[model samples]
Target chain A: MFDTLAAMLDWFGIVVFTVTGALVASRKQMDAVGFVLLGTVTGIGGGSVRDMLLGRLPVFWVAEPAYLLTCVCVAFAAFFLAHIPASRYRALLWLDAVGMALFAVAGAERALLSGTAPSVAVAMGVITATFGGMIRDVLGGETPVILRREIYATAALVGAALFVLLSLAGASREAGLTAGFL
Target chain B: MFDTLAAMLDWFGIVVFTVTGALVASRKQMDAVGFVLLGTVTGIGGGSVRDMLLGRLPVFWVAEPAYLLTCVCVAFAAFFLAHIPASRYRALLWLDAVGMALFAVAGAERALLSGTAPSVAVAMGVITATFGGMIRDVLGGETPVILRREIYATAALVGAALFVLLSLAGASREAGLTAGFL
Candidate 1:
């Protein structure tokens, strides 16, 4: 089912973001607790914000403990692997891009399911894709990379909007999502 | 009416927090944009997070533009007044405490109105009281005062819990709110 696929993608995105958060924390020489906190927030912050704005109760992570466990485990893994070559950051960036793409589609799809207008759905997608990273950067005392360079937010916005338009044009849900993800 | 009184308190709290935010920006010698952004975030962050978690749409400032306007104006004013004596930080701290008290009560009341469990309402109150400052500190690259020392979050939590208990004991809403505020 599409819901199952979506959930898988969501989990994948959370793991990717969590690792990125842990990487950042390790670079800052933060303690284990700091790594876990950063990783957890970065993994869940965006979707949590979106759910809150939608008046959804029992935030997604709170409702599902699996996500929390995954983040914690990933944080610990990343912490121990912090000495991996600097090239790991390049991999992190690519993973972040994939995560952002999936999260954007997921956010837009959720907003549409909630009966929001198309524009709102698109906006929600951008928020979901970007907020986690922003929060991570802020908490780590770095200016958010999204605001500096790169078309990060722009890519998410376009992807979400494209998905919405494709859906409106009667494309299959999977097709629309795939197109957006690409 | 109770609504009017609540609105007044909310506005007062926003202004106080905004000023505190701008003061932080000034202390850091940030640019004008920094001042406004910090001020606005510190003024609205807690309530916005609370609303998002509660599934409240559009957030409060989005529904009421006046709060946004007030924050912008106050931020600019505070930026210019940054040269005021060093004693201003102390005054700002006290004002922040008052804002925290008011916001904590308001947050708890709103959560109760939304039918959240009493403990959840108290948590929301603490979040609404502290999150804005945390965001400001994080973005400004300063450690959040709430995490360092002081009874900041504890005070908010206690106030919210007291309000809930008083209300459960059949106190008038105003009396419960006043008790929490004090």
Candidate 2:
């Protein structure tokens, strides 16, 4: 049940990030292919960066190509449904925040499992939470939201640190994850 | 002798790219640490991207700590020596171009050695040649040079493709490298 919940949360985070990427593509007035490209990259990019830093071979999406297919389908859905949206900007921001929190906790868990230093785990968590959006924004021809003097990254950092510390202190994984996500 | 020369060329390309990154930092009027960060990232960023795409475990710098040290030392030297001002803009452009060519061939060679298809090899070469500058420019708060209406990427693509084709046609590695670098 723990693994199942964790996996579901991870997929949810990815879907959220993919929606955000496709929304950015819509804002950029890109073609369908552009939406898929941006969305897929945004979905997998953060985890890939974290894995590369931690020396995890094949990254995750490479070993399991289902993630790429999921991103494509999600992005396509977003692209089509975006036309019917009335006020997407606010929802986009909210979804992005939720994705950030989920990824922060999940990334830290992976780092801890890898037996990295506590600090490295925290850093990886923040990186994993934020890097996908950075790539999306950069590739979408805009300045990244994190560089816009936003407090979002700071929140992620604090949350990630708290989670790692809690894990190190022998707290249950579920407790730590909830604390980090909250 | 071939191995020695190949290694020397690789290091030269790194140094040249590092100088361009430092020049970008200088243009941005960044401090010493910022300069170092930008320089080292520019020096190794392209190769790292290539390694990640090819699923090369540990990336190059992780497996060989010496590369990181080289980047750090070179960046520091660049930071200190940049004050000796002569018009550096032209030198920066030329150095970047040379570095791009060298990396293009080297990256293709690596991709082919990993048994990727010819097209993938060419693509990797271009990514390894250009991704560093893109990262440096993006992080330095500027649009990437590749995004500009420039013939640079076209040149990189042509060069990379030619190198891969030459290798596929049974030309010597040295010959392909030379053709690509030219």
Best candidate per TM-score, number? 1
DockQ of 1: 0.15
| Tens digit of per-residue lDDT, candidate 2, span A21-105 | 8888788766665576668768877888999888886577655557767887999888788876777777778878888888888
lDDT of 2 by residue, B1-182 (tens): 65565666667878888888998898888989988999999999999898887788568889888888888888888889887768777777778788888888778877777777676677678778888888898888876655442356656767888889888999887787788877
Model 1 interface CAPRI class: incorrect
True contacts kept of 1: 0.20
Docking class of 2: incorrect
**Residue pairs clashing, model 2:** none
Instruction: List, residue by residue over A15-87, the lDDT tens digit for candidate 1.
Output: 9889888887777777665676678779988999898777676577644557767887899888888778677
Candidate 1 residues B7-57, lDDT tens each? 777788888889889988888889888889999999998889888777776
